[model samples]
Target: MLCAYTKLGMMVDARHLFDSMGERNSMSWTTMVAGYANIGDMKAAKEFYDLMNENNAVAWVSMIAGYGKCGEVGTARRVFDEVVVPDASSWAAMESCYAQKDMRQKLLSYIQANEENVDGTDATVWGFFIRCL
Candidate 1:
């Protein structure tokens, strides 16, 4: 229900539901994080993300993408760099961020740096490469 409200951009309703919940699992917490991010409230998203008891890749990517969406590419990069164990999705999120910002040089540099580390088969990164060219 909360996710439904969030997906529909009804943050007020979602927040109400979130506040009413006595206990929250990671999914519930992550939903709020994503909700805040989707609503362009990166500060709120970060606050919830930092409050997460166990930060997973999805949560980290949420912040990365949210910061990027808000045009805070440098902060997004910092989040990318601070990730303890970044998976392919994390790298792809950063790449997408750079691409969306049209920072071609930075995107190229990042691609080159991660050429060996990234999953070549990942479609998102491949899409980034295609967009860069």
Candidate 2:
């Protein structure tokens, strides 16, 4: 229901339903974050993201994409930096954001610097960079 409301752009109802819930799982938290982010409500998304006990890739990617959509690439990078262990989706989201914003040099520099930190053998991670190039 919360997901449905959020998907329909009915955040007010979604929030009401979310707030009334006694227990929230990661999916519930992520749904709110994604919903808020999808609507360009980064403040709300960030608030929910901060409240999440265990940050998942979906929520992290959502925040990055949301900031990118708002033209806050720097902030998106900050969110990306916060990921402890970014998955392929997170890398793809950040790389796509950088590409869309024409930050090629930054993207190359970022990829170069971060590649050493990422699993050098993870093809999915490497694939995003390859596609970016």
Candidate 3:
């Protein structure tokens, strides 16, 4: 219901329902974060994200992607850097941000600096750069 409300852009209703819930799980929290971020409400998204008991890759990537959508590339990078162990999706999100913003040099520099950490199976991230460049 909360996700449905948020998906429909009924944040007010979503919030009302969310507030009334007795026990919230990660899905609930992530829903709100993704909801607010979808609406360009970073402050609210961050508030919800920060309130989460444990941060997950979904939440982290959402923040990075949210900030990226808002043209806050620096903030996105900061969020990406905060990830303890970023997965391919996380790397793709950051790379897409830099690519979309036409920051090719930064993208190259980032790839070079992070290459050592990327395992062989995460070829999608490298493939993304190949297409982007």
- For candidate 3, write residues 1-133 as lDDT tens digits: 9999989879999999999999999999999998888787999999999999998898888888888889899999999998998888888888877877988678767777787776756777668667657
Evaluation by TM-score, superior candidate among 1 and 2: 2
List the candidate numbers ranked by TM-score, top first.
3, 2, 1
Q: lDDT order of candidates, best first?
A: 2, 3, 1
Candidate 3 deviant stretches above 4 angstroms:
none
Backbone clashes in each candidate structure, one number apiece? 0, 0, 0
Question: By how many angstroms RMSD does model 2 differ from the true structure?
Answer: 1.5
Model 1, global lDDT: 0.84
For model 1, the superposed segments whose C-alpha errors exceed 4 Å read 114-133
Q: Per-residue lDDT for 55-90 in model 2, tens only?
A: 989999999999999989999999999999887788
Q: Pick the candidate with the highest TM-score.
A: 3
Model 3 is weakest, by summed lDDT over 10 consecutive residues, at: 120-129
The TM-score between candidate 1 and the true structure equals 0.83
Tell me which of candidates 2 and 3 scores higher on lDDT.
2
TM-score of each: 0.83, 0.91, 0.92
C-alpha lDDT of all candidate models, in order: 0.84, 0.89, 0.86
